[model samples]
Target: MYGINSLIKSGSLEAAYPLHSGTYKWTVSGPLSDRQIYYKICLKITNYEMPRTEMEFDSSYIYKCYILDCINHFGSLMFFGFIMGRALDHPGVVISNPVSEAFYRNCAGLSCTFEMAVLQLTIWFVRSCFKMFTKLIIPYLNVKKRQKQHDSKFPNQKLRQWESDYLLNKSERYRIAHEYLDTVAEYGYVTFFISSFPLAPLCGFLTNIMHLRIDAYKSITLYRRPNAKKVPKLICFTKLLQATTYFGILTNAAMIAFNSDLVPKEIYRMYYNASLEGISHQQFSKIPTSTVYSFYKYKANEETCYYNQIRDDNQNKTLLYWWILAIRFAVLLGIEHIVFLVQGFVAYMIPDVPYSVQEQIAHQKKIQSDRRETEFSFNINRKKSVRETERFVLIK
Candidate 1:
């Protein structure tokens, strides 16, 4: 990909007339004619049948092209999970990066502060830009490569003429769209962002502008007009979100534990410094609740603390970190139990057959069993008779 597009493309530049042909389309077209003229040429010779209207791909049982759509729907679930794992398992560019200097840098190695939030947001913004550029450029390059290969095989042809007709009975209008890919990618991005940076959803307000506009530009240019289907909700992506809610909890805990200094130094040392001062949970709970402190030198007039002074055993100021873990575990178990209970209740609520119908069903099953047994016996006797007749004829 040509790395960055610092140069702007605006309609106002049309009258410059620097090597400009007097054609309006040229002025309106891109510096790269791949989208305008080349694409139009490709469309002209494309091997598709003429239809004024669009049609759906065959959904009949015979060919079952709809099955491909169904498979893709489910495949997005695993794809999201894979993206989540890869993203979170690595050292993040923001909070996870180790700091070499203490006072030398503006922000700490780890803290849920505005500095860290900004850093995380900036990283996601850069990533969004890179992803946008790649999505726009790579497909066109791939298509161009394929077009060349087609030209080699069938000398005056393009992809339009590469095939006689659509792969399915309908227009190949059912081509894959950016929406499905973007949806799944967004699922992973959101989960990872929430898990890593709580302020990520807020940060999305900025990055989405770049993402939406870039996607709109590509849709208008690089890609073919796809047969539009109205998808109400992405079922697999919704289920993935349900799974990642729990996953986000784990990642958040990990980030707090491994990377951040949210826990007090004494408590942290007890856990990680391998101090022989073996501490018990009872001692931890009794270790008098401390005042939550803020290292931030500046605060607004409406400064308020997130958590109240803890008077209970489980309400340690760090949201009693252990209590949070325990509560999450309990909630997970409760959800599973509720789901099972609901399933059982639904099964019970299903209508039962009338006594007469039940009796009729049982009687029909019995008749079928008897008929099968009779058929088996007849088959054995018939085979024996045929064998005996064949032996007699051979002897004769």
Candidate 2:
């Protein structure tokens, strides 16, 4: 079984599983026997195996695939956030003043995030629609072709009716190993660059909600019944999420310190006792530029420009520049430490397993032990009784 699973994973084999019956009519008509119903209920309760019926199998497969896709979508979202931040950092779009630059970047980040959310949702929706079209139309074309062939082969005989399940297109299979890769990537994006765009969480939430419904619909109605398999606990996915979250904290801290004017504004407020608005207008010096011929073949007069950076007459960085740089680093370090400490404290306070669940598990163990003892005692008594009967027979 292990080898076959490995082979399936490697694509050497298509699939190896108990085939489901090709229809769900039995569920409505009533199962063949009580045992069949019992098995169906057990399959539903345990979720250890999928039902050997087309509708149940397809439903289960669709659900599992939808979960996997959602994970992938979230990971992609996170990655998109990270990429947006880095991509928007080009010099062409950035302003000269620190405060203005931060404001501009924030606005741009928000717009991009919203746009990306929309784009992601649109793509998923369009893909689903296309799949649904193919699912409904392709099978129909195949049925027509089959009918044509039958008519030519047996002109006098009546055509046989085909089951709907037999006429539907086969479901497309996906790789389980690569299922969570997109999710990991999106998670990294969302957490790592969350400071850049605060609306990311909301955008992610909306996307997931819409995506869930779309996926469910596609799985149940558009795709053919797929071979269902049991999914084990996703330890790797959990660990990846944890890793991304921790790393995101650090990235957010860095973004807050370096990408925004928060640290500089705070430092100025502490040392100079000046307001951010006043500093924006009065603190920076402007450099005048000479009139020059434009590259586009037009002469232009250049005006004075204001910059957030401080430089001397010789174009060297001033003492204030170094000071602000040092302070930024300090702020970054402090933010990370503070956030990490809070995270650790919270984690410690909240245990992984709830107390109620732990008590229930203990209770279950006790019941099992009691049942074992009762069985053991009953077996011993039965053996003694048999020995006594044999002795009585010999005496007689």
Candidate 3:
């Protein structure tokens, strides 16, 4: 009954986390004593008469949160790009400036800004990679645990679908990690080669650095992810690996801060969750406790129950890691456009700095200097002739 309860509770937590964050109540199938429910209730009970040690929110949920973030950040930035492009050609903004030079200069600035944005995008990519790698480790651990449990149940062995799925998910993660590495290389190389555009040359270098930073995170995943199932030890030595990765990320962040000039502030916000830090623990505690209470309360009624006893497509749909890469690209593009808009507005507010415009401005300055020098010489010659004539008259 406890094992059944645990299964039901796990399923309930999985279902609820993606949906809501607050108080919810439901009923269970079995006729259980209030004592059982008292033992089972894992959620926060503001009413002290019904005491419950709130189960900590699963840290694992962070994987999903990160994925959603990746989606929102990049997807919005992509739309912003289209707006910036359209705004550049608008009659009001286009007509006010020296048309051709202004156009090229603005476009060039846009290119530079984008090159800087790659750093933020790269950090996101790495974070996703780390998350996926951890997922793979988890499934592998699950498979092992399942294997030990299975041998006791049946002497003759046939592998189950869950085992197969775990293996498949594991293989997929490895393949995806390699793909990310390949992409990092490709983007890095191409960014290095392009030099004709204003910011093209910096693109390759910045991208390479981004890839290296992300790749470094794999070490952390290898350490932390392997131990997801092992929570008993006083200090999981494996966690030290995660700590190392954290340090690596901090180091990378610092390097980007000082060494790389291409990072944009908006893009950086996407990587770290400012609102999450304080709220994270409270958020983490609710899921498991809530799951135990809710699943037990609703187990008997199939119509009301959100999860099935057996794994099905609905039960197994938390594959956000698979789609994370595409989502990040979309979000990064949106962030880029927003940054560009802010920058353009700020530049418009401040007085234009000297020689920041096109080469034509420098040429015009040179012509004006030449004209003034020529006029000064002509005036000096006229005064000299008048003085010479006056001397000649006095002598006569």
Candidate 4:
């Protein structure tokens, strides 16, 4: 029955049929008088409860989590390549000046990343508190409500005791699905918009480290032992990770190229020999004398100064704008190709199974085959000896 239940749960079987627990009745045919017979039978099957003392933690889960963290970190670095590679902005550029608004916008990404990290942590903390509260308090309230409906004092006492025992047992059981969902959420949060903040990996690491400790403490003190489940692989999460990897590469490339000042700075440095300060001063000097009504800010501006790096000729994008735009696209394409090539090279170089492990697996298979052959020969010999001994005894 346990095997059947396991098979059903694993999707290897449709159902276990014709087995039930109930009173069965049938008419007796051989009796002197027609009589009906009734038999009460009950068959119950349940999962073998894993004891807390015997629970073996799988280290692969931890390794996978760290691997995901590393990926997110690396993706963030790639997204903000200028931080490590080259100086994109001028050294003395003032962040507060309206002319340096582009640089400010770039810096805003970092701020957003930090904000998101805080938000994720706060959400996890609140969720954990709520879960603990409901687990401890809700069942007691339910028991109290049931107690009010029972009128007899003695039965109520027995009922309360049973309810207390049930609640204690229930509180000990851990819901693994909740943990799995939490991990998934954390993974998504770190990987999906990682380009917006290069420090996301750091935040993720701190969160995961704390989360690991909390989970360990809960398992030890608050929750009962969880059932041991055997899974071939984390198939769903593995696929999700693969998809995220590809998406991250593309997303980081686009983010660096468009969201940051890296491309424009490069274009300005290579194509135009003028300094950003000089250009800003020239644009400011050329500002129209006529007062312009700015509806967005609801203010009248004496000078119509453009904060963007585009040309001020009739407010239309100049050749430099198109050139910068093209360069950005080129950078995006180049990054994707280079990253994918490195990924392929690394994957090819690293075999999933090491040579040592492969040899051990082969040796085990060989031993099993040899044992099976020996057993087969022994079985044949025993059958022949048994037939001969029977024939000899009959003849004697």
Ranking by TM-score: 2, 4, 1, 3
Poorest stretch of ten by lDDT in candidate 2: 15-24
What lDDT does model 4 reach? 0.48
Best by lDDT: 2
Residues 64-132, model 4: lDDT tens digits: 443444443333333233332122221223335543442223322212333334444443455445544
lDDT of 2 by residue, 337-371 (tens): 99999999999999899999999999999999999
Choose 1 or 3, whichever is better by TM-score: 1
- TM-score head-to-head 3 vs 4, winner: 4
Candidate 4 deviant stretches above 4 angstroms:
1-165, 168-174, 193-195, 220-228, 274-301, 309-312, 376-396
Q: Which stretches of candidate 2 lie over 4 Å from their true place?
A: 1-163, 166-169, 172-189, 276-278, 281-304, 373-396
- Give lDDT per model, in order: 0.41, 0.51, 0.36, 0.48
Ranking of candidates on lDDT, top first: 2, 4, 1, 3
Give the poorly placed runs of model 3, Cα more than 4 Å off: 1-83, 88-135, 151-396
